[model samples]
Target: MFSASRGFVPLLAAAALTGVLLGACQPQGAEAPPAATAGGPVRILSAKGLNPQAGEASPQGRLLIGRGKDYTPLNEDPKALFDKLEGSMAERRKTGWAIVEALLEPQKLTLDGKTYDVPLWHTWYEGMSANPEVDQKIKLFIAQLAACKADADCHKSRAEIAHEVMAQSGTDKNLVRSLVSANLTQVLKQSEGFDRGNPEDELGQGFTLFSPSFVEHVLAQAQGIETCSNKIPWNQAPPSAGQFSPCVEEFPRSAVMVKTNWDQIDGASPKVSAHATDAAAVTAVLKGGTWPKPTLEPVDPSGIYTVQTTDGKLFGLKSIHISTKDTREWIWITLWWSPKPDEDFGQDRPASLARFNGGVWSHYKMCVTTAFNETDPKPWGSYETAQPALAAAIKASYDGAVEQRNPAPYDKVTTWCSNPNLEHHTGNGRTNCIGCHQYSLTWNELKERPAYFSDTYAASMAAEYPQYGRARRRANFPAEFAWSFGMEFQEQIKTAREDQGFSW
Candidate 1:
């Protein structure tokens, strides 16, 4: 009976195994798996009240893992937000004149008794409209804070109060000043790393704090300075009084007009000769009236020519012009009598005239061409191409002159015209074509401030050349060629004077 029971057991086990395999291969009716919740906690449908999903250890139940009902979203504290806004306002103020003007509107505040109108103010305000909810919240906060009766009340909710203040017109003087100062400080800090240390380098800081024009205007107002004239209070002065001379013998009272064709002038550049031939040519090129043949005005060889103007002040004649091609372009003509011999008086006169006409007048034409070409639709085909070509032509002419001379060994030359302190050591290193003639400040100054070239070349060049469109926008020219010769000349003079035991 026991053996029979064992056989039956084996048969039953085999049959169960076969049934299990068949069941595994057969398809059973099954429910589809649940889909994933987008950016939300996963949930299992099979859990209940002890709510394992709510517990950190539960994986098979609904979990509120992020900012859902069980989790609260973090809020930026009012104080921190207000502080950030204040910082932003200040940064915008330093960037440009426009922002400063907007910040200093009449209703808001004034600096140095002047109010600037910044167009950017409206644009900034309008930008806030893009976020109506935040804008409304800011507006409400501001209204409540402004309505507060005391500082104690304002401090009750400091962050709310600050938000209100920033959203409003910013009329409080102390607040406005603090904001401005803070913005400037931030700009100064960020600007430390800039190699150039110019205003453009801090543009981002400026825009964040204030608009461009407003920043410039406010800074100017703060400094109590004017950008146009650059004249300070201490610099204003009247013309000097004329010196009187007693009548003397030996010196003739007669004056003779010196005239030479621009082409005949020894120092005149070929570029100059191409445009102007004589005084008339110069006047025509400059759009000034033709200069008449000069007749010397008589003077008491010793007594300078004095004119009693209608204003009743007797002033010595500095110079007078007989005529000009265009009266509009005529600046002024002044003649100075030579205190020394007449021969010594005219030593540099011809060269000076040619320099003035070629360097100044031709430069003006180049500038006009540049401006027109920049604005023209067909600029490349127009005068635009002419500028670089002309510059090249001028450069070639200068090179021709230097090449014609006998080559001086670099070691034989005591000093380079550009850097007199640095001596050339090798005979092989001859000064190139550009090195000799590229130090022309007259031409550089014209490029810097075309409008002011005729009236104030030196001053304009000093102010604008370092930050001019070309210098600021394009790659910097090589220092060897771009620096003014005046500096080199001054250095040479200083060295010579020191060698002679004289103070510069």
Candidate 2:
């Protein structure tokens, strides 16, 4: 069974965001103006996203060069610099920004005899189940499981089972490795897992997309390990189960995952606070079922990246959580739509973003983290240097929470990067992207449901949170710092086992 406490804090307690529905007769061409922003005039860059006909690998290569001489040019070999995963926090921040720029760059796609320009990442990724190869892989694994169960003394290793399956089945390894990914489905719970439909009170829809490289790495590991079983060698160390392949200089795109939170926009209102639910309200919010019923009708498209699903539904991007295996611990970055785009996390956003595609994306704010502990050196990337107000805001928020309970110490040294929309559960203001993710482990290792606040603070000056803190004081193997392995893969295998009529 999957771990009961998936390490998520909880959803925001705020009331659901509401919208004023427009008249049903409005023409599609009569698009409303983009939401007003402190960054200046809104630009309508392109009408592109999610082409149903285009496959995962359809749109490849960079679209635009990043601005400024220091930034790596995306049009060139951007991954070359990204692979560096430099030691210093400042350099890692720059690399993180460069990667985000590449992801946001528009790519061209044609649908129904018309051209649409969408962000490269949107065109390049799909839901994990969307890949046809995964089902085949699951079947092969199930066969291996049944064979082992039937034999009295079956001592075959995962490698042996994989070899046998490949030889007999002639499995196409490359096809499995080339697929894109998906399945986060809530307002702000993108990282939690796939298709967790919104519970009442949660506002928007969330999607977590994986690049081909990320899928390839996970598939390679699944092919080599028995993820569904609780009998994996528990004593094995770092390179064993749960640990993902590293992002090295040789393989730059080892693993790249993005989680985006979106709200349905009503073109008549175009308010950030508004949602498309008002037009075609959900008849009921399923507790543990599929997305709410009574499909939300499409509102007229406004400014910002908006997509019209094949079902004629519409969604507007609000926030994004991006974690790339750029560094050993990975670079944690988040961007969210804000009326005051130039303040806090959005401070120091390059002018190139404003100029690119007529500044359509200038309304989003960004923050990145490379190190577990925040040590601010002047003239570099720090909440203080890059965004002092953000640092103060985080501290203030933490202080308010601390009055109610004994929360972790809030100070300048606490590295912070919390998406307000996504990370609202518990003391989310005090939580960094690396904190909860560090607890990502296999089902066997996490069966105990270790203390969430055990290793929140640094153990000492020498070690970071993952190695030295109380939470990870015990020897454990991580599922590559990715919660999806347990939440998605194990769940999929569980379903597959049921399909094979195999009881746990």
Candidate 3:
């Protein structure tokens, strides 16, 4: 994941991007006659179009224009961009060393004006510490970039940055080169007189800076940091039942299998009940050692299992189940191994549980509100446009679930329950729709299971089970899901927490 694949390539690429940007900024057309004044604020004059201002202010009072165009205030000056870089470096330097300590401090990052001492910062650091050289170089580059006034200045400083980053790139010279090149390109783009060309070009370059490929490299390093940080014993006591702490346990022996039943069971009579029974059956098979290999099987073509179930009884159920009750009912199955009490489960398990529960609520809400009233302009016009409408419906449904007690929209079941057999359990009071959905096995392990339900299951399931698919496809689904579920969750969490007075 390190950006610098080759030692020299990134340096050269950085130089090239700088050149392109600088070329774009240069005055275009014939040389203009000497202006009466030295020209206010080194305005960039170009026929090809100058780079837009880097920050809030314009260069001097006048805008820089094309050689033949009228004299207007420049959107930005090279010096101003350089100053911004310097300012960012200063801020980082002032706070960078203290990042770990600040992050580890209780009640640091705030949400909705409330401080959350969640392990998010620690998790981030875990991911960051892996590639110390990359982190060091990036930090150093930030420092240098902040101080650099021109491309040449950056180039001078980059040698040191390159050396630092290169030392840590391992044997992957190509990766090192690529990273360095990209960084240089970014630095150059930040310079004055660089031309971005068309909108597509500008967008492509801008996005690249924030792209997953870039973020992944940073995150991969962060993950390494997480590993190291986790190894370093904390002085604080373990977290309590509901509060987020580093004491969370990892689940052992977890797997997901997709199951489909060709038999068309009555859609009305508790479809998921049959599926749950089937899932139990599959679990029994896997536990009984029926399958020749210890691989997970599908409860249905669409359902996923971690362990092989005998006779495929659980392997037959297809649709996921949900009851429209105010109370929550979910099955927690541990699928992975971990020695440490708190570090055994996958990272995403809690989130997955929460999402699954929330998703059920969402579907139920959709069914109740929009099921009978099909002619009411169909909330979002039609199923084709149902995505956004579904989202709105889910949010409204969550609100409904929390407010009404009697004449409940849905029946109440168990208050909250997890399989007592599991080694690490979050228990009832603290658990919510979001907490369980955050598990890694729910989405990560399940994603690997095949979809036996539809020929188009790969495509349709691609919408849900992204982890089983190609990298690019997997990358795209989260954003879509976030858009689909995120808005609803935000609204729902607020209402649920307020009504329930729940703490996380």
Candidate 4:
């Protein structure tokens, strides 16, 4: 069974969604965005209207406005960054759906001298290592600091200032020693295991992508500590009397993060099922310690999106979790490939999606929750709406939470969400997206940073375990609900200890 830590993307086996094209996905017969020169500025044509920087509302009353590139000020005033997600449940779903379509547009990447047109979301800069240029700059700084490690005479130098900052913060002594004992390569690769899927499932490979704004905020904070600590300026508790920390930072409202799961199809090819592989198959794939590059051909009749890497390996997208900081609480959405997509989760998918990329998106079923629980006034899907599938899915999610309680005193509530490919094992399947991620926090000890507590996946755990529920979450929003950041912090600790020849 899978543990609470891991989560994944897929095309839908369901029927196509129907609705008006909201300028997120392409309109009828619209072509994918033209490929840009590799290493050049992204043209971003298809995402123009969806740009939250425009600060406008759509015809459906959805707030399209969101914080964008100029979001640095948002760090000082976190609440101002939140734009309430206004509109009915169906309208809100359209907003989320539009966001998904906008991200799915083709983005070209040059890997190993070959151009691959992957989804825009796939092109986000990998966070494990800073870009080469940035890495070089950091290395130079680290080298300078290492040179002045024990020299009392170098106190007035820039390197000394950096060392002093970290030393005063308490966590830096271990970090500096760890960097000195190990080569730079080890430190950069330390956080790479974040997307290793569940160690329990060998065929699974997951990737988490961060929006440029999100990365920028992280870098800005890192720069504050001389690029040594990945710490965000957060407090131990929520703000008092509606006042937020002037220095407390968070991912901007425009910050959109995605986690995608990939399947290793090797010889399975056309016979591959539109579902998760069994554990036996996973064990077979990981018989050795090495993770083989996935290889597989498309299922002949189904038009699911598959990727062939420069290494001659083939991989298929299995599931996707998209989250945005549009609202203060953020919007949670998950999409998975379903063999029977049009049923259950796919029943109310919009029809207009057929126009985008030749209906490639129609093969994916999606569900989204803007609030923690079902706050909709109507009887779930009782009202006539353009996106009944979204409404019903959300309702079903809350209902599932209610059922999980089994009796009375179900005071705590949340909408359930899980990806079949990503959150498949044990406690994961019954998890709520936000409910699990809300625990993305770390200890506030300024001296020695500790390891991260595991995340939760069981639905209604909040009601059963109030100590770690929303109240605890509200009091401790350490990583601002971005587990990757917290993981990065902890991985550094691991790298430090390992480099010092200490093994757990």
Best prediction by lDDT: 2
- lDDT score at residue 406, model 3, on the 0-100 scale: 22
Q: State the lDDT of candidate 2 residue by residue for 135-202, as single tens digits.
A: 45556766676778678999876546644654443311211122112222343333333222445435
Q: What overall lDDT, based on C-alpha atoms, would model 1 receive against the true structure?
A: 0.20
> Please, what is the TM-score per model?
0.14, 0.56, 0.18, 0.56
State the TM-score for model 2.
0.56
Residues 372-487, model 1: lDDT tens digits: 00112121122124234323322332232233232222111111110000101111012221222122222233354312212221223424322111111111111112111122
Over 143-248, each residue of candidate 3 has an lDDT whose tens digit, in order, gives 4334453345355433444334434422221111122212211311111233324322211010011111222232223212222211212123434432222322
lDDT of each: 0.20, 0.43, 0.21, 0.42
Q: What is the model-wide C-alpha lDDT for candidate 2?
A: 0.43
Compose the digit string of candidate 4's lDDT tens values, residues 310-354: 122334455678887766667778887655566556666676655
Misplaced by over 4 Å in model 3 are 1-504
Indicate the TM-score of model 4: 0.56
On the 0 to 100 scale, the lDDT of residue 264 in model 3 is 20
In candidate 2 the C-alpha lDDT for residue 162 amounts to 48
Which whole-number lDDT from 0 to 100 does residue 437 have in model 3? Answer: 35
